[model samples]
Target: MAIIKLSETKLQELKEVCKSFNNDKGELINVLHKAQSIFGYLPAEVQEVIAKELNVSVAHVYGVVTFYSFFTMTPKGEHPISVCLGTACYVRGAEKVLEEFRRILKIQVGQTTPDGKFSLSCLRCVGACGLAPVVMVGEKVYGRVSPDGVKDIVAEYRN
Candidate 1:
């Protein structure tokens, strides 16, 4: 795969973050967190730089990244849309709601829109069974979402 090169300023900034962490290999997760915050996502090239700085194998870094569900290698859109797919949600027609989002957004789960305005993903549960079919855009949550309500929800973010 081709490397995504980092600019000089970004490279220097990432180095500073490592320096702040003392470059201890045990702080790999913390380093990765700061790196992701700086770069938006943890790409292969960034991971390579981190591995070298932290004095650990790239494989080890990759292992830790993949182990955590919160870590993502791809960039997310400004509005990250998530649909709940827990047992309660599934039973309450969340599948149809998810399909509507995919149909309208034209992107599959884990994919961001070409314009980088929105992303689609599925989560197991949000601990809101009372509102089983819950959809989240950023931190805001919409409960009892239905397929018909999808267009309005998508439109609200169009601007």
Candidate 2:
């Protein structure tokens, strides 16, 4: 695949992050965290630059990025929706709730809407068993979410 070119300014900004960490190879995780914060996601081009700066193989950088669930290659929408799928949530009907979200948004899990307003994902748990079948939008949690409540929840963020 061809490299996705970033603006000159973004490259400079990324360089500054590397410089801040003193380009220490051992600081790869820290650098990646900062880089992800700046770029929203760690795309291939960003990973390439990071590898070159830290003197590591691109494969190594890619490996670390993929190993960490927190890092993402694709950009998430403004309102990222995460549904809990842990045992408690599943037993509480998270699957139906998840399906409802997919239906209303017209995008399956791991996809963002075309308008970039919402992205859908499922996590093993959010540690809220009492609030089972929960949905989190950004940092806000909506507890006890039913399949019927999916439409209103999605509409809450619609512009």
Candidate 3:
């Protein structure tokens, strides 16, 4: 992963977020969430700032960031794709669907495309078993996805 320099403005914004939570160690998770929102991903530099602001160790902040699937140390694409690998989706051919995405996007799970247009990942469930074989692009959910339909899904955001 490439190292990114955190801008002063964004650093101030992160500090303000921690301040909003009184910089309480108990609110570490909350602070992390808000920090992620500001910086997109929690890089080591951001984590260091957060640790100092919260009066905690950098290890503690890193532990929480890595512990939660919601947090990411690397940046995501403009449109992130998450495939549901839960029982329902898996049994329904989620793996094939995932492969189709890999082929079309030319990127594997947890990787963003070279053009920075899309990123692919897998999750346990999306709470939409009724709509099995689910694929989420950003906040929009695509249900009943099949290998053949992957191209069309990618096309939706190509422009």
Candidate 4:
């Protein structure tokens, strides 16, 4: 898991987001989202806080975070790179592209760089099979990628 550094303002914001639910029982998931929004992923401390405020069990809250795809307990990189591994993308060489990213980044999927520059991950499909072998860096999408193109593609964001 990546370590999360939170500012006092952000911590207050998390509490505020949790408070908006107005109901301790129904606000669990909502608070989780707010926490994730502020921190990118929920750290253990955030989960503990939410559990204490909502009167929920820490195990229960942790379970929810672990079960949901949207929740990430680990800290993500500055730019999260998600590669598509859908059948179309796979046939188009998405695996090779992922390998290239791993090699260059020197980190496995779901990991952030020591410098906190990028995090690499994979998905089934970005729903853009026509652009098989697609990769998304944050909101921007790169399609029809090749293994050789990984470095250049990632480089565009470094600057």
Candidate 5:
């Protein structure tokens, strides 16, 4: 992983976010969410800054960040693609759909395309079991996705 340098402006914004929460250690999760929003992802440098501001240990902050699935240390692509691997989706062929995405994008799960247009990931459930084998591109949900349809889905955002 490459080291990230936070700009003074961004660093100030993060400090402001912490201050907004009164730098309360109890609001660590909320602080992390705001920090991630500011930085796109919680890199180690950002984590360190957050730790100092919240008066918490760096290890504690890192533990919280890693423990939550919603938080990502790496940056996500402009279009983050997520596959549902819950019991219903998996039984309905979610794995095949995920493979199709990897084949088409030429990137594995938790990887972003070279062009930074898309990134792939998997989640246990999307709560859309009725529409098994689901895929999500950013905020739009595509239910009942098939391996064959993966190409069209990728093409839809190519332009």
Candidate 6:
């Protein structure tokens, strides 16, 4: 994946975001979130920039990014897919749906397709418990999905 370099304007904006927080330690996650929002993902250079601005160590920033499930070190696809694997969904065969996605896309969980069109991820739950076996593409929610439904769902975006 290509690294997204932060522009001066972006860096300045990040500084403003950083200022809204009280301290570096407390603001790590928020800063990273803002960085991800701007750059799509948290690259090493962006970490370095954040470290300099926040007066934190690059290692600390890297550590936080790696430790958090919400952080990504690589670019995400144009359309990101997250399958719910909570107990309710899992019991309803969400795992099977995830397996189907891997079979069709040839990429495991937490990976993006080489073409950069799709990325797959897993979530503990979407809080839509009534909608077990849910697959979310971007902001849209898809419920009651089956293993066979993966292909159609993927193809819908392609078309």
Among all candidates shown, the one with the greatest lDDT: 5
Give TM per candidate.
0.83, 0.85, 0.86, 0.90, 0.84, 0.86
Worst 10 residues of 1 by lDDT: 1-10
Q: Report the Cα lDDT for candidate 1.
A: 0.92
RMSD of each: 2.4, 2.2, 2.1, 2.0, 2.2, 2.3
lDDT by residue (tens digit), candidate 4, 5-79: 668898888778777876385778888988888888888888987887788889999999999988997788889
Clash pairs detected, candidate 2: none
Which TM-score value belongs to model 4? Answer: 0.90
lDDT of each: 0.92, 0.92, 0.92, 0.88, 0.94, 0.88
Clashing pairs in 4: none
Q: Estimate, for each residue in 3-99, the C-alpha lDDT of model 5 and write its tens digit.
A: 6778999999999999999999999999999989887789999999999999999999999999998898988888999999999999999999999
Which run of 10 residues does model 3 get worst, by summed lDDT? 1-10
Highest TM-score, which number?
A: 4
- For 1-159, candidate 1 gives per-residue lDDT tens digits of 676778889889999999899999988999999998888788888899999999999999999999998889988889999999999999999999999999999999999999999999999999998997999999999999999999999999999
Error of 2 at 3 (Å): 6.8
**Worst ten-residue run, lDDT, model 2?**
1-10
Model 5 clash pairs are none
Error of 5 at 37 (Å): 3.1
Clashes of 3: 0
Q: How well does candidate 6 score on lDDT at residue 60?
A: 93
Quote model 6's TM-score.
0.86
| Displacement of the residue 12 alpha carbon in candidate 1, Å | 5.2
Instruction: Show model 2 residue runs off by greater than 4 Å.
Output: 1-13
Write candidate 3's Cα lDDT for 1-159 as tens digits.
Answer: 466778989998999998999989999999989888897788899999989998999999899999998999877889989999999999999999999999999898999898889999999998999999999999999999999999999999999
